[model samples]
Structure formats: structure tokens, C-alpha cells
Target: MKLWIKLAAALLSGACTVASAQNFPNRPVRIILAITPGSVADAIARFMSQDLTARLGQPVVVENRAGGGGAVAAEACKQAPADGHTLCMLHVSTFSLNPFTMQRLSYDPFKDFKPVTRMFFINEALVVSPAVAARSVEELRKLLVANSGKFSYATLQLPGADYFQAGLSEQWGAQVIAIPFKGGGEVVTALLSDQVNIGYAGAGNFAEHVKAGKIRMLAVNAGSRLKEFPNVPTFGEAGIKPFKIKAWWGMFAPAGTPEEIVNRVNTELSRSLADAKVRQYVEERFMESAVTANPAEFASFVRQDYERGGALVEEIKRAAGNK
Candidate 1:
């Protein structure tokens, strides 16, 4: 009699779990953005919303909460119910850089959230203004060494720019300045007006400008040469140490979300990217498609990136101190 009762209880538990997955996201779903509108991540989030709503049988909304280098959006995501209704868009900065760079971080990335799937990976380009005479990384280094304290670079909200600036300064024995901007558009403007000598950002930000011959891409932090810019060499080919961490965007839900719900969302998002139009949009934006086999794979990637960020922070500290 005791064995029969136990088996009945187990069957009931399994039934309830299946039911929960079927009824998930009954209301409108929200995707919190870590950056403001007009950014690459923001555009992708908004693009995915329509397809996700159809696939999930509910409305999907995107909300921008950009500030604190992704802390504001991250906090909002952490506070949301772990019911898979509220998702957040996080990049390398959120999982990798923020913990080390930002003080008094309100939420722990691994503890506070669950990885869904990586949306895309952006290859960061190190570009120089047309006004600058440098044509390659080697030339740029020579220019920096020759003109210390006279060159500056504009960066987005992430502190990785500071690391790049410091690394270059220490390596070349120059005073390279890093100016922070709120968005990529601002960074582009700074470079276009020759306000800054160089700019480090996603290749998409300067795609049109580069084609127009307004800015010159010295090097890209990609594993191989980009097809769009086959002539441009990678950092390794340019004789510079490639950045250890990659800049990628992924989806996340508040921790404690049911595994079934998380998997369901991941499946839908993957299907959405499979659409030809979506794939084209991503490519035109200069983003590499970075879909993972499963959420566990993404989680593993994040853990590795987190360790790399720690190493980078130490390197930045040493470089800054030496300078």
C-alpha cells in the first residue's frame, strides 16, 4: 500500500510540471534592455520581440533601462519574478566586466540570473579617424609613442575601453586617454568630428562611415578576418594581443525560473533567429550569429568569460599603476 501511494504522488508531480510549462507566460512578457534604443543590442531585442510573442502565445515588450553600465537593467531583471515572464538582455559587460569594475554591485550575475541563449557576438573594431595618418596598428602605435598625451579615444558605457586604453598606453609608453560616451552613436560622432584620435567599438557602429571613407579600421578583435572587411587584419595579424574577452549579447531570466520554461523560451528564440530575414538583419549589423545548443552551453560560456574578465581587471590595474 505504501509503494502504491508513493508512485501515485510521483505521477501527480510530473503531471503538474508538464502543466506549468504549457501555461507559462500567460500574460505579456517583458525584455529589459541594458542599453538605450538605437544600439545594436537594443535593435536585436526589439526585432526578436515580435517573433517571440507569436511563438509564446502572448505579447512581448521591450523596456530600456540603460545606466550604471548595465547595473540598472540587471537589478530590474533580478527583482522580477522568476516565472520566465520577465527577461533581460545582457552583454559581456554585464557578466564579465561589471562585477570587477563597478563598486557595490547589487546583483551577482551567476546567482541572480539564468542564461537563456546567446543572441550574437560582435567583433570589436579599433578604428582611427580619417584625420589621423595611421593606416595600421603598427603605424598607430608609432603615432601614439611619438605624440603622448595628445591622442584620445571615445568608448561606450563599458569599462573595457579603459582596459584597452591602459593596455595600449602601458605597452607603447604613451598617455592614451579614454573618454566615456553614453551610446555608440555618440562615439561615432566623436570620431567623425575628429574629437578623438581613435575609437574602439563594434564594427557595425562604423560600417557606413568606413565605407564612406570617413574612418579607417586599423584592426578587429575577431578570431579570423571578417568577410565584410577581408582587407582588414585581425589584432593578432596586426601584431597586437587580441582581447581575451568577446563582446556578445545574450538573453537571461531571473534565477529560479523553471527549467522547462527557460528551455521553452530558448527554443522559441532559436526558431526566431532561423528566419531568413532575421539572419540577414543580424549580418547587415556586422554581428556574428552565436546560437548555443542549449542553455547549459551558454551558462558555461558565461562562466569562462567571467574568469577572463577577472584576469583582464588585474592586467588593467597593473598597467594603470605602471603608467
Candidate 2:
């Protein structure tokens, strides 16, 4: 009788676990945003959260825990229980570039998080202040070469955006100085204030500035011209061949979250991405929906991005010869 009772207890425990996993997210779900309120990241999170709330039958809330180049929010998500209730919207720079930029990182981009789905891709645009003489990408390259080291550009981050600018300078044989700012908003402010001759930032961040004639988008770092800015030539079209780098956003959960839960989230996110409202929201915001990928595919994409970013960092380190 003792043995039978033990067996029954074990089965009951297993059944309860299964039931809990199945019911998953029985309460409200929280999404941690690594950026401050009113930021582009926050805006995207809000849009997605609203859609998810309707689809999941649970309130989806976005909580901003901004700091440390997104490490703060990421760490918070990492420390959260490995339940589907707590998740984060991981940016490309945080997951892929931070590892290469920061000397010491707290969490493993891969091992510490389970990727759910890629939300959207925001391509960066290379824009010059109207005060600059250059109008097109080639013209800008020539102007930079002629002025060599006289031209300065601003980027949001040190090793991510600035590193890409460094690579562009090397590839184009231009002596451009890269100035770092706290965020994209500051970068735009500096460009508008004529504090910097050139700046690199997401199209969404500079859409109004570009429209206002405060900045001229010379070339876009995308395979082709974006739908919103079709008139603006791509880097390739402007003779700056092989210049494509897209900043992506994706959903992630704490590592060790149940596979079933992760799959459920991924499925819902995938559906959300496909919804006309979501697509329209992204389009209006100058973002493009990335092709939907499952957990394995998202993991592979993150790994590839990490490797690519690492290589870029190595090249920058070699060029600068700094520790």
C-alpha cells in the first residue's frame, strides 16, 4: 500500500506539471522593454502588446527597464522565472552587438534566452545634414575624401553604429570622424543642430527630420530601397555596393522555459506579425516584418548575427589597435 501511494503521488505531481504547462499564461503577461518610454522600441512594444492582449485572452503589459545599453532589461528578464509570463523584446544590438562591444557581459545571448520570433527589421539610413555639400552617396564619398577627416558623423552607440560607420569609411577610403551619442534621438538632434555633418540612424527615427528637409538621406543600408523611402536610393544604387545592415527586434523568454510555452508564444507572435493591422502599423512606422521563423530558425539567426557582429568588432579593434 505504501508503494502504491508513492506511485500515485508521483503521477499526480507529473499530471499537475503537465496541466500547468498546458494552461500556460493563466495570468497577465509582461514584456520588458529595454528602452525608455516614447522611444521607438517602446512604441513597437505597445503596439504588439495590444494585439497580443486581444489574441491571448490575457492582458499584455509592456514595462520599460531601460539602461546599460539594454543590459538592464535583458538581465531582469534573465532573472525572471522561466515561465512564459515574463518575456522581453530583444533588439539586435543588445543580443548581437553588445557581446562584441562590452568587455564584460552578464548573460549569454544564446544560452540565457529562448528566442520566440522576430518582430520586425528597421534598416538604418545614412543621412547628411542639409548644410553639407553632398547630396548623393557618391557625392558624399567624394566630399569626404576631399575634406578627409574634416567631416564628422554621429551614431547612437560606440561599437555598433560607430563600428558600421568605421567600416563604411574604410570601404570608401574616406577619413570620417564618428561621434557617439546616447541615443538615436540625440543623434538626430545633433544633426539638426548642425553639431555633426552626417549621422546614421534608423529610418523611423529620422523620417520626420528627412521630410522636414533638416537632413538628406543619402543612402539606405538595405538590399533595396524601403517602401516608405522609395525615392531615396539604396547604397548599392548609389554605387556604395554591399552596404546592408538591418537592426532587428525579436521576442525572447528566459532559458529553460517549457518548449510548449515557447511554441505557443511563437505561434501567436507569428500570427500577429501576419495580421493586417500589425503589418500596417509597422509600415506606417517605417519598419518591415521579417519572415516568420520558428524557435530553431530564430536561434540560428541570432547565432549568425552574433558571429557577424563579432567579426566586425574584431576588424574595428584591429583598425583602432585599442584594448
Candidate 3:
């Protein structure tokens, strides 16, 4: 009789767990950002967060934890409960950049977090200051060769930009040393001030400067010709066959979060991201909506991206004579 009572209680507990999973997010949800509030990352988070609030029938809040190259926020999110109430907005850097560049990371990006959904992916642009005379990749190659060690190029460490710039230098046999900045804004500032001759960063960072004609983009790594710069060609079109670089955005939850809750959030995220306004905002910023259908597919993509980045890191090290 005692044995029967124990079995009944176990069944009841399992049933309750399933029902709770169905009605998850018993309270407000918080989204943590690794960068500042005004960045394109932050803006997208804010835009989609509104739809998330409505779709989930819970208030969604975004908190900025901008320090340590997103490590600060990544750490905070990892330590939180796995109830699906907390999610972190990670850029390509969180997975691709930090792991390759930083030797000691406080948290394991792969182990400590579970994929929620990809947010956006944008191409990088190789732009030069107006002070420089290069107009094309070929011309820039010649310039980078002539300038060599005499010139410096700006990049950010957050997204592991060092690998991209280093690879470019190796491909062209240019010995220009890479200078690391905190983020894209600093890269743009260095270019504008003539503090650096060349910069590799997000298309959005260079969009305004390029439009104002303050800088010239030699080539882009976009899926197609950027609508804003219909005349410029992609890196492949420009004969840069050895390398292609892109920036990405995504969301992650604590590792132990139930698969059911993960799928549920992803479902709502896909639907909300499809809203006309949010889609328009993403499109206008030279970003595309995530093509993932659910958490499993998105997790696969994140893993693949990380693996690809590892290969690039090794290639760059070999080319730069640093390995």
C-alpha cells in the first residue's frame, strides 16, 4: 500500500511539471545586453522586446551590462535561474570572438548557455579614411603593401575582428599591424580622425560615415550589393576569395532551461520578429531577420559558426606568422 502511494505521488509530480512548462514565464522576463544602450544591438533588442511582451503576456525588460567585452553580462545571465525568465543578447563575438581571442574566460559560452534564437546577421565593410587614396580592393591592396608596417588599421576585439584584419593582411602580404579598439564606435572614430587609415567593422557603424562621404568603403561581405551602396561589390566579387566576414546577433538562455520553455520562447520570438515594424527596422539597418525555425536549428547554427571561427583563427595565425 505504501509503494502504491509513492507511485501515485510521482505521477502527480510529473504531470504538474508538464503543466507548468505549458504556462511558463510565471512573471516578467528580462533580456540582458552586453553592450551599451544606443547601439544597433540594443535598438533591435528594444524593438523585439515590445512584441515579446505582448505575445507572452508578460513585461520584458532589457538591462545593459556593458563591460569586459560582453563577459560581464554573459556571466550574469549564466548565474541566473534557468526558469526562462532571463535571456542574454549575444553578438557573434560572444561565441566566435571571445573564445578564440581571450585565453581565460570566466564562463564557457558553449556550456553555460543554451541557444534561444538568432537575432540578426550583418556584413562587414572594409572602409578607409578620406585621407587615403584607395578606391578599390586592388588599389587598397597596393596601398596596404606600400604602406606596410607604416600604417595602422582599427578593429574591435568584441567580435574577434583581429582574425579578419589579420587574414586580410596575410592574403595581401601586407604587414600592417592591427590596432584593437573596445567596439565599432571606436573604430569609426579612429577612421574619422585619420588616426587610422583602414577599419573593418559592421556596415552599420560605417553607414553614416560612408553616406557623409567621410570615408570610402572598398568592399563589403554582404549577401548581396548593399542597397545603400549599390555600386560597391562584395569581397568575393572583388577577388577576395580567401576570406569572408560577417557579424551576427543572437539570444541565449541559461543552459539548464527546459527544452520545452526554450522552444516556446523561440516560437514567440520568430513570430514577434516577423512583425512588420521590427522587420523593417532590421532591414533598414542592413540586417536580415534570422532564418531559424526553432531552438534546435539555431543551436546548430551557433555551433557551426563557432567551429568556422576556430578554423579562421588558425588560418590567420598561420598567415600572420604568429602560430
The numbered model that scores best in TM-score is 1
User: Against the hidden true structure, what lDDT does model 2 obtain?
Assistant: 0.80
lDDT of 1 by residue, 175-245 (tens): 76778775577778889998998998788888888989999998888888888899999988998776667
Where in model 3 is the C-alpha error above 4 Å? 1-23, 67-69, 158-161, 242-245
> Model 2, which residues run further than 4 Å from truth?
1-16, 243-245, 321-323
The sequence of per-residue lDDT tens digits that candidate 2 reaches over residues 1-323 is 99999999999977876787799879999998876665565777899899999988899999887666678778998999887999898787777678878878888888889999888887678898999998887788888878878988886655443556766666766767777664567778888899999987677778888888888998787767887678999877877655334578889999988888899999999999899988888767777779989999999998888887777766766766532
Candidate 3 lDDT over 147-176, as tens digits, reads 777778886654344666667666777876
Model 3, global lDDT: 0.80
The per-prediction CA RMSD against the true structure, in angstroms, equals: 3.6, 3.2, 3.0
Q: Candidate 2 at residue 249, lDDT?
A: 85
The residue pairs in collision within model 1 are: none
- State the weakest 10-residue window (summed lDDT) of model 3: 155-164
Name the lDDT value of residue 125 in candidate 1. 88
